[model samples]
Structures are given as structure tokens and as C-alpha cells.
Target: MSNETTTADGGVRKKGKLGQRIAYACGNLGQAAFYNAMSTYFIVYVTGCLFSGVDKALAAKLIGVITSLVVIIRIAEIFIDPLLGNLIDNTNTKWGRFRPWQFFGGLISAVLLAVIFSGMFGLVNVNTTLFIVLFVITFVVLDVFYSLRDISYWGMIPALSSDSHERSTYTALGSFTGSIGYNGITVVVIPIVSYFTWTLTGAKGEGQAGWTSFGIIVGLLGILTAWTVAFGTKESTNALRAKAQKNGNPLEAFKALFQNDQLLWVALSYLLYAIANVATTGVLLFLFKFVLDNQAAYSMTGVIALVSGLIMAPLYPILNKRIPRRVLYIVGMTSMIVAYILLGLFSTNMTVVFIALVLFYIPGTLIQMTAILSLTDSIEYGQLKNGKRNEAVTLSVRPMLDKIGGALSNGITGFIAVAAGMTGNATAADMTPSNIHTFEICAFYVPLILIVLSLLVFMFKVKIDEKMHAKIVKELEAKLASGEIVDDEAQTAETVEAIDEEAKTLTE
Candidate 1:
């Protein structure tokens, strides 16, 4: 949705343009698809096969251990993702600072994914005293490349366009298209795994061999899909390009987060959302196996994705027009809360569970997209307040929170499973009523609780809205034009003005 306003000289305009909008959409689509793969597939693939090997319970433990290791590798990423982002923020190339990173980042990540998958298959001989070590090393390699690709990928958004609205629109586009890839990958994974495991086999069948092949295919697609954004999008800012020439301290770039309160809130809020999202994705296997009664033949989750995705765009416009973003976002998070609670409470009926999946998708997509748009807006507020533009640093928070939250969620889920007795019975063809309790919590309680908490951070803690951001933008533009420092007069005036406005209210 576009908001119209008159400038200081009374010229009417909307904040962002269409080109930047499209570019943001592509970048997000590419980025989202890449992220979706890790959440939906990686752990499930690992544990499902290992369960057939050694003791199923021990295999579950192994899956938890390895996936947790992958998650831990991601923590090291707190330093790495942003470091890549900072490098992109400070780099200057004829090709532009952000896109170059995207191109190489996507290509490199895809390559490493292949290695990760290849290693997964050959891991039988390797699954010994050195099992954990080899798996950790292999996954970490791909994880590092993912860090490079993800940080460089998202950092492009603020650098590409200065308009808050454009960032949202483009973010929506990226989200929409990327959902295609996201859902597509899951859909394909469902059939592909089923096919390889069921079809490609000797007396031993495919076993581990099948899953490994699946990883290879997933990795190749990730590489190509991510590269499309790097080459397809462009950056609009010139000031940032010039900023690269000064050779300022790299530490100062990340230091922007502590100094900018709006950005800090955005990052913190993102962290909360990331936990809910990762948990939601983490439970896909549970939903498919027990929630759907192990109808491994037909792909119910893939169907959920296709149906939910069809309505995401129109749903966004309807929610945005009727509810303030805050309320719309609340509706989205609350939907997840309700969906998960229901799943935990009474999901014995596959029919009802399937229906709830539909309900869950609309709000989940809405909340995810809205949170992303909010992050872009937060960056604009950061530039408005500080008068120093650092898109990469400012925008890095999304991916930063994503990996951090994901790591935390993985650690928690693994711990939860171990405590709840997921030893090997987690994937039993017939789950007992007691085990169903554990599955319910994983699917519903975890996601619903996290989302409700996220909404609390957003609704009660966040202060800025649209009006406040517009006013800040107007004042910052004027200051930029006149070289008037945002000193006592301007700072006090804006601070007070911020109180009277909307969108991004945390002027602190």
C-alpha cells in the first residue's frame, strides 16, 4: 500500500519507486528460498535415515547432536554474516557493492551444498568415532557459505533503495517469488525423497544413498536460485558508494546497531520472530508423520504450501488496508499461536490438522512479510535519526537474528526431544498416545508460545508507526540538503515530533 504526502515545498509524492520495489522482491525471494531449505529439510533428512541405522533412539540422538552442531556452527556466524555484510557495506566495485556479493555468495553456497549432500550419503563408513566430527565439518562448510550468501543477499535491500515503501513492496515481491522456490523445494523434496527411497535401491534399497542424492539436488538448486537475485538486482544509492572510498573502521559499521535504537528494536523483534519461525519449520516432520498419520504416500505439507501461497499477496493487501500494520502483524502471529495451540490440543483428526495448516499459512506469511517490511522501515528510521547511512549494517539484523534464533531453536528442540524421549520412536509407524503428546507440543505449543511472545515485543515494545517515519524522512532530507547538523535544535525538535507521529516510535 502507498501513502501520499506533500513535501516541505508542497510537492506531492510517494516515498519509493517501482524499480527498487521489484528488485527488493527478487532479492527477498532468492534469500527466502535459500533459508526455507535449511529449516524444512536438513534435520529431518538426517534423522529419518539414521533412525534405520544403529538404534532408532540412538539415531534420534545422533540427529539431534549433528543438527545441534550445525546450529552451533551458525552461532559462529554472528561474527561471520555481519562481517560479510560489513565488507559489502564498505566495498566499492564497478558492479556495485551489494550485487557482487550476492552473485558470488549464491554461487558459492550452491557449490558447498553439493558437498554437504555428497558427504551425507558416504557418511555410513564415516559414522563412527569420527561421525560427529566429519558431519560437523561438512555441514559447517555449507553453513559458512550460507552465511556469506545470506548476509550479502539481504544487506542489498537498504543499499538498493532508500524508500521505505519500496523496500516493503520489493520485500513482498521477494517473499512471494521466493515462496515459490520455498514451497517448490519442499514439494519437490517430498516426491524426490519418496521416489529415491522407494525406487532407487538394491536389496539394501536406497537407504542412506537416497537421502544423500536428495541433498545434492537441493544444493544445486539453492546455488542457481540464489545467483538469480545477485545478477538480477541493482542498488540505487550513491552516497554509500562514495562512503566506501574513505576507508573508515570496519568495527564502526557494526557499531551502528548499538547507536541506533530503532535498528536495535528491529533486530530484537526479528530475533523473537526467528524463534517462532524456526520452530514452525522444525516441526514439519512431526506434522507429516503423526499429525497426518504417516500417509507418506501423498504429500500433504506440499499441498498446504501451494494453497497457502496462492492467497498470501491478496491477503497482505486486505490486512494492510483494514488493520494497522501492528494489528495486522498481531493477527498473523496470533494465527500461528492459535494454529499451534490447536495442533497441540486436538490434532488427532488429520482432517482438522490439514484445515489448521491452511489457517496457519495465511497469518504466518502475513507476519513474516510484515516483519520484513518493518525491518526495512526500521533502517530508514535509523538513517533518519543518525544521518549516517549504512544499509548493510542496518539491514544485517534480519539475517543476524535469523541465524541466531535458528541456532537457539535448534538447540532447544534437540534438548526437548531428548528430554521428551524421542530416542527412536519419534518416527514409529504407529505412534502411541503418550508419544502423541510429545509430537503435539513440538508442533503447537512451541510455535504458538514463541509467536505470542514475538507479538508482545512488537505490539507493546515497538513504538514507531508510518507517520513518525515520514516526518523523520522529511526532516532528514532537508538536513541532508542544507548540511545542517542534527544538533540541539533539530534533535530536540525531531524527538518531540517523533512523539506526535507514527511508524517506528522508538526514538530512544
Candidate 2:
């Protein structure tokens, strides 16, 4: 029997099963694991381990170069990501548009990640120039493929279900599993690296071989989970969806994105939130190792984040029912502000730090889930306003903003480590009071300021709430019934401009 059902507007939507939701959620697990390994730990490995055998001055210079490369490449990808999204939107294949990209992109990026983590097979010690060349090549390819997979993976959310509540459930489940995969890295990396180091080289400390092994293990896990997403999930198909799959000029899709005022506001707000949120991650290991001199306790933060996810992930849909997203966003941001204050005041106390993390994460998880829902909801908003549903293009904004934020974070992290003399072969004993102070300012205070900006933008600029979204959906259904909205590919420039003017006037 067909799982598809026709809506009042005569459009078809697929009803997903529990297993399909679980399978869709699994994609985030692999993606987050793969992403965190690169975003959170790759720099740490480069600064602390990859350059340990090189000359001090040369290593410092190399770190600077590598950091520059990372930031530049990620920034470059911001432009490329939208095109990739359009490509995905235009894709039609036997397997499906999203799944093929998810599978192949994930698989190839995983392999490249493993190879990159292997430090290009120790080429640096033998030939520095060759290592840099290969690093550039591999890293660029890895990032591109990773972006493709990320876009396709997230782009599936709206396609899974158009109902707001069901969409929230999927987003929350993905976030929950994704946090486990992302934060799980922090919890397991030290133990895994330590144990593997001992087993491989009979050493009790971190080594190249250990890091390489960790990469391979993560890669394999990524591949397996991505495969599950491809084989296990289903995409909703209808006349509209089928038409959307037809090839169109990416420029039209890109222009339509700017017409959606709500999407713009959400995108801007999420960009600030992402930068503020991710900027602090790279500094956590340094904080535990250099400031507190307790490397092991770093994992506790991850555990707290995971525990918070366990508690808050399921709570989102419940809380969302009773509270408006704007209110929830404000509450979460306010909690994070308090958490930062506590962290800053009690930097040296592990107990206080752990408490601060708990406070930070519970709300932090809520905020992330809300941001995702906001972004997802904006797709419908854009469709209503622009008369085109560029789901991949609209959703692509999230990851693009993430990469920009992550690049900035990497730059900040690398700069702090080098300036504080916390890089390669440095010990906690070697850190002066001034160095500790620098780390504190960059790690704690900077993100605090960014978080405030994010909250302000969200509170003031973003206006869509549950009530508004329901209204928009109802209007869209009417438009579909009246034949006012048609295939997005057939949307003409004059028609879109007319709708944009009407939308602008309505807002005013």
C-alpha cells in the first residue's frame, strides 16, 4: 500500500514511520562526529601534536600558515555551499536526490578525513613542502564533500514532514543524537588517544599513531551511519517535489533567498549564535590542560552536555507547546549569560566549572534546537513570500553560517594558543599568569559578548512564532488550492518581483 496521502490542497505528502525518523536522526550522529573531529579537535592536533617534532620557530610559523589556510578555505566554502545546495535541489537520480549525495559525500569525506588526520602519512618530517601541498589538496576536497553531505542531510528535514510539530520532533531527535556524536568525541578522545598511544608505541602519552587510529575509527563510524540514513529513510514525493527536482539556474534560487525577510533575520541571528557558541570549544582543552592542569576533567564538560541533551532534547517539543520560540530563545540566552558569568568568576574551580557547564548546556541545547526549528520554519516562510520553495538553498544558510563561525573560531583559537605559548610541547607549568589571563579573555569573555549580540538580534529582528507559522501554512494550502502557487522552476521574475513587493508592503 502507498504511504502517501493527499492534503486538502490536493498536494501529496508522505507519512514517515518511527523507524524512518530514527534513521533520519542517525545521519546527524555521523555528521556531528565527523564535523566535531575536524572543527573541535583538528586544530588541537595540529598545534599540540602534529608539529611537536619540528623546530619551535618553524612550527609556530607553520601553525600560523595552517590556521590561515583553514580560515580561508572555510570562508571560500561559504560561496560554494549555496551552489552545492542548488545542485542538490536540481538533482534527480534512481536512489533519490538527497540520499546519493549523503552516501557518497559522507563516504569520500570520511576517507579523506582519515588520511588528513594521518598527517598526510608523516610527510612533514620528510618533506615539509610536500606535506603542505597535500594538506591543502586533501583538506579542500574533504571540506567540499563534507559540505555536500551536510546540506543533503539537513535538507531532508522539511521533506520528511511539513507539519510543524512533527518537524520539531525530527529536529530535536537529530540534535539529540548529533550532540552525542559531537560531544561524545570530547568524552572519548582522550581515553582513546591514550590507550591507542600505549598500545601502538608503548607510550602513556598522545602520539601521531593514536590520533591516526582515532581518525580511522571516527571515519568508519561516519560511513556506517551515513549509509543508514541513505538506506533507512524515505523522501516525500509529489507533483511539487518532483517539479522542484528539475534543473534550474542557481542564480534564481540565490536571488529568491534574499526576498524572504524572515529567512534573512533568522540567518543573521543564527550566524551570531553559531560564532558565539563554537568560538569557545577549541579553548576548552587548553583551559583544562593549562589553566586547571586537569586534562581528564575536560571530558566531564562533554558528559554534562550529553546529559543535558538527554534531558532537553525530548523536552523541546513539550516546552515548545507551552512557550513561544522567541520566549524560549530569550530564556536560553539569558541562562547562557549567567552560566558564562559563573564560569568566568570561578575559572580555577572544577566543581564550579562543572556546575556552570550544566547550566550552560541545558539551555544551550534548547537554543540550538530552536535555531534549527527557526531555520526550518523559515523555509515555509520563504516559500509563501517568494512563491518558491528552495528548501536546500534556504537550509544551506545554517551550515554556511556555521563554517564561517567555525573558521573564525579556529583563527581565534590558533592565535590564542600561539600568543600564549600553549602550542607544541608546551606544558601547564610553563604558562605564566599573563598567559592564563589571555586564555580566559579569549575563551570566556569574547563568546559572552557575541552571545549577547545573538540574543539581541533574535529578540528584536525575528518575529515568526508558532501562531504565525500555522497561519502561513494555512495560507499556503489555500494558494495551492487556488493554483496561485505552481512549480518553483516556472516562477517568473515578474511574478516573484510582484510577490516580493506585496510581501514587503504587508510587513510594513
lDDT of 1 by residue, 15-103 (tens): 54565455545555545556666655555555555545576656665666677777778788677665666676677888777667667
Q: What tens digits encode model 2's per-residue C-alpha lDDT throughout 1-100?
A: 8887765433345677888888988888989989889887888888888888988999999999998999999999899888988988888788877999
Prediction 1 TM-score vs. true: 0.84
Show model 1 residue runs off by greater than 4 Å: 1-30, 55-61, 127-131, 202-206, 238-248, 314-323, 412-430, 486-508
Please, what's the RMSD in Å of model 2? 2.6
**Winner by lDDT:** 2
Off by over 4 Å in 2: 4-14, 238-243, 488-508
* Number of the top-ranking candidate, with TM-score as the measure: 2
- Taken over the whole model, the C-alpha lDDT of each candidate is 0.61, 0.83
Candidate 1 scores a C-alpha RMSD against the true structure in Å of: 4.6
